[model samples]
Target: MRKLLFFVIIFGFSSSIQAQKYSKEVLDSMYSITQQTKLELTKPKSIKLMAVGDIMMGTNFPNDSYLPPEGKGPFDNVNVILTQADILFGNLEGTLTDEGENAKRCSDPSKCYSFRSPESYGKYLEETGFDVMSIANNHIGDFGAIGIKNTSKTLEKHNIAYAGIFAQPSTIFEKNGITYGFCAFAPNKDCIKIHNLTNAKKIVEELKQKADIVIVSFHGGAEGLKHTHVTRKTERFYGEDRGNVYKFAHTMIDAGADVIIGHGPHVSRAFEVYKNKFIAYSLGNFCTYSRFNLDGIKGYAPIAEIEIDLDGNFMKGKLHSAKQIDEVYPFIDEKKRALKEIKKLTQEDFPESKLIFDEDGSFTQQKE
Candidate 1:
């Protein structure tokens, strides 16, 4: 009876959705009126959205500046970077709390990288102006269901908003006059296994109607490979079942997603203009400890800032490229050269793609 009831509940929720079909003119007009957020109908005044790749706070590569030395890590540097944005975002790639004994990180502490950062890190995340953290990565459930539960608890305890880890509503967040959503999928069954699609689609479709802007984050695709590349067909990491990123992202956009930021391919993928919506294939590793298997171009990461006008519409943004050169004990530092290199690489990844360059490691779209 319990199992039957569960299926009924899922069906009930899935059947209830009224997705809005938007025309280009209406959307453009909406954006124009809310260009800088002057619309009273649906305006957020000012919305600054920032995103990075993976923040695998692994204990294996313990460092002082980047992560906490020991008990209760301090998120000072992360806060410093995030403070600048009104709504900061990133993929927290691990469980925050120290709970559960069922799924241990790995047998070998060293070389075993199931990130378990101090739950106290949420304080700095909140204090740093981070409005939301996407738990949709391959490590959100690293320690199993217990890890997901603990991570959610710790983030909430510190007043940090998170999504894409909980069952259904657990991964959905609507705030700041914008209905934001995230869903983390994986191809690996060992670490952070994901087995839900109805829940993911339901969340996206629902959020599209209720929120002014719907930002969907996906975490999948092959890792450490140059431009891992997204095929329209289902992707397999090592014959596992990494959903087709192209399909996943485009499907979400078609369902009224304003923006789609994906990260899982630890190396960046090409940014494409699909159906008039922007899709960042993969942002790569944001704050990682190991550079193993990382080649010349795969290690570069960028701090992407997407600015939505007052009406929650996509306007423009700057890509601030950065690097994590030192494998262990590294600090989040911006490399001017790395930014240029990444820009050039991005252009190459999508030969048909356009790119704009700037001095001091920043780039705006020439034709976004």
Candidate 2:
């Protein structure tokens, strides 16, 4: 009888310890220690995530001629690179509604752009291997609530997750035994506000508790050709507050975000490493078509591929240089324009950062 009782006691203790292994405090401590040590454990399980900036993929709301050729042919050049990643993300800069009056009123209808792609375009996103998209841009609500609802349904039908909308500000999914969470923010109607740091931190913290890895995407910063650098201060465009992207990224990192992706500047900015977390200030225009100016700096952007360990520690990244040719399709640039520009921007904007980018587009952190 005593032997059986001892065996029961041992089993109970072992189970209790196993249960406590994943408690909040324990996990926090483990992550902190791993980050501090900066240990590159041998053969640790990791996930590769690829992200890009604003993508319109051609719009055919008021006109059908703007749509790309019937099928997945539009993504022929970049689909392979996109599909290779475990998770592919991008910013969907327009609504996917077939019929809705545009809510945005521009002084000059000719210059003020509003994109409304047909619902069928969602299939293109799915075929291109876009797992998640951020609907937190200025153009998402071009057709108001109906536009938002239809866009959500279209993305759902295609089995693509989206964040930054009214109903779904964050999403969680599991891949290869790892749980990943994504949330997006923007200073636009019907989207999570990027300027609200308190709310942003709260949302990110809640997501961090629910998933092993958390990625935050924000659409902030001023726009156009001159707004290419990270000023590290609140930026304004046409007297509108665009939020301080630098402060926002650092705060999100401190709040347990594993990766921070920024866009909306329409130009690529610098990269930074904070607390062993990776942050790309702005990815610029990825695959915009028509209604967008693709001149000089605005045309160059990077297809950022980042790898992180199971614990969400920064590992390495590669920037695939791409450019929007003829203001339409995005093609791989042989000149490595985006990579070289990012390297220069990173050095200029974040001179003290520990992250380093090589000529071949590969990136690593400075060893302690």
Candidate 3:
């Protein structure tokens, strides 16, 4: 009986030890999971994105006269405003190739303009806080495949992400633990066509699956000051179909795009908030140097600084106005002409919008 009792006690003790071990393991696992959850909750959830339009600092195609001076940087005047954002974006209006044949056939040589910035000029964009560039514009193919290849190589070397051509339709990148997907569209050859909504939707939907936020850039609309307004209908510029920007923006948002930025008009346009997403119809001429026609409204360089949640909901935004004068680089406009133009255009185009604008250049969506 004593032996039996001793055996029973030993068995009970072993069973208790096993139970404790299992419980301890479960508790440890639960604790680890809880800690991981806490970390996730503490991770950064907001991103500041800054965007500008049409950045052709200078081109050496025709001659060296169109290029900026040796010691002076193109963005030196507005570097402070640009360097403040987490992601700085712009449309690269030209190629970054030193030597390539100009493929554009000009009926009138004087009317034809081909831009080919030197390869060294890419560093200036990088230094000026340009994180990504849209190589999906009319001028991207001026120098043919070699220009595209050289531009890609230079951007890669500078760690500046770029997309929009047939070869590189979209790009995925990470910043501050948030994954971002970016794609660009244009009506020009060799670029991802802006008129193809089906393809655009497919690209954006695929990006939404993998990225925390998706940004879509379209180079559409008619060019020059007369075409500054969003007409809501399909626009044709110089016999080319510039997609209906209104339809495109709404469609992209429906297809999981969080932000829509439009350019190619070479002038600022209205701002819109659709389904809680932000859209900038056009950002205007940002840093086009000598060869550009920076006359009056064409010189308005508005820097759009936007804040969005990790899910890419529009939070707030600010428009910093800069203007190009004397056919030189852009300088901060104390008159706030660009902001005023945006405000006026937004009011005229989207009067029913729920966005609240302040005199200080800040704007936000009205809380329902």
Candidate 4:
């Protein structure tokens, strides 16, 4: 009798049909409800994810002079926009340690650039709503193993997730009932190499099996204004292979990556839509305090807000323009320089791409 009652309840049958006998109307209603439930479960849901380029609030390694006066105030201007997204991401340009041995050997101490931000500054990232960060850039290893360890611990203490180093190649976390898998790669030591497509594909494939969406971040490409465009081939900086970003992005998408965010280059590159996924080749320098070159396009700080479905397909996006002048902080760019730069680069690099950028920085994929 208990089993019969369970069957009736499972089928959504009336109490009178407890005997497992149902009228045509009852059966039809049950089928309709089942189909509706399936449709609801299979429906695509989207989440807004905001991404930016290299972010180093201040470096105390050389001296405190490089530190910003406002400290956390550097992010105040864009906090409102950043908090609006479900996930906020940026590339941690340097270690969050107060002191550490300089990893790179430089004969001229004055010419050396080693960034070591205070550990307390991690709170600024948490308060600014940064859900995740990519610590797979060239500067991440500036202070060596100690720098890497301290930065990881600080981010963990602040409840922020980070990846790219070999110790923690990828991370899976949950937000609002959706699971996201994130992994980062770089061409630097102690970091996951972006050049190894075999390993990258394996990591992404495994992430796709366990997570609802997969996000891949790579700190590749040559640096500076002269290397702003995607060459669709391997890039080398000072004899280091930066990996072929064009090939890497597409290969990751094929491996089930939903979104790809690229950095390392200190200037925004291009945007492309392939296999229903969104890829930003480079976001440039978002918030770098003293010691960085803030001239011409190098100063442009663009915030890319991408809306993607549960399947990780691109829905729409927008680019918010911001720039750092002589100050260490970034302010809203009234001239929309970031938007203009990305538009020009994307057009020149990926003319066949389906992405359409408007004058106001709003973008969407062209319908098939």
**Where's the lowest-lDDT run of ten residues in candidate 2?**
35-44
Residues 269-331, model 1: lDDT tens digits? 766655545677788776665523445555666677766664445556666666655453223
Best candidate according to TM-score: 3
Clashes of each: 2, 0, 0, 0
For model 2, what is the error of residue 219's alpha carbon versus the real structure, in angstroms, after optimal superposition? 0.3
- Please give the CA lDDT of all the candidate structures: 0.62, 0.87, 0.91, 0.90
TM of each candidate vs. truth: 0.73, 0.86, 0.89, 0.87
Candidate 4 residue-wise lDDT, 1-368, digit = tens: 99998997877756556644557678889999998888767654778999999999888766677788763576998887888989899999999996688888889755789889999899899888898899998898899889999999999999888899989999998876678899999988889999999999999999999999899999999989799999999999999999999999999999999999999989999999897889999999999988899999999999999999877888999999999975558888989999999988988898788678898899987777
lDDT of 1 at 44: 59
Q: Looking at candidate 2, what is the lDDT of residue 155?
A: 94
Write the residue-wise lDDT of candidate 3 on 1-368 in tens digits.
99999999999999999999999999999999998888688667788999999989888766777787889898888999999999999999999998798888988644679999999988898898788889999999989999999999999989998999989999998776678899999988889999999999999999999998899999999999799899999999888899999999999999999999999999999999998899999998998987788888999999999999888999999999999975588889999999999999998998767677788899988776
Candidate 2: what lDDT?
0.87
* Pairs of residues at least 3 apart in sequence or in different chains that clash in candidate 4: none
The 10-residue segment of model 4 with minimum total lDDT is: 13-22
A best-first ranking of the candidates according to their TM-score comes to 3, 4, 2, 1
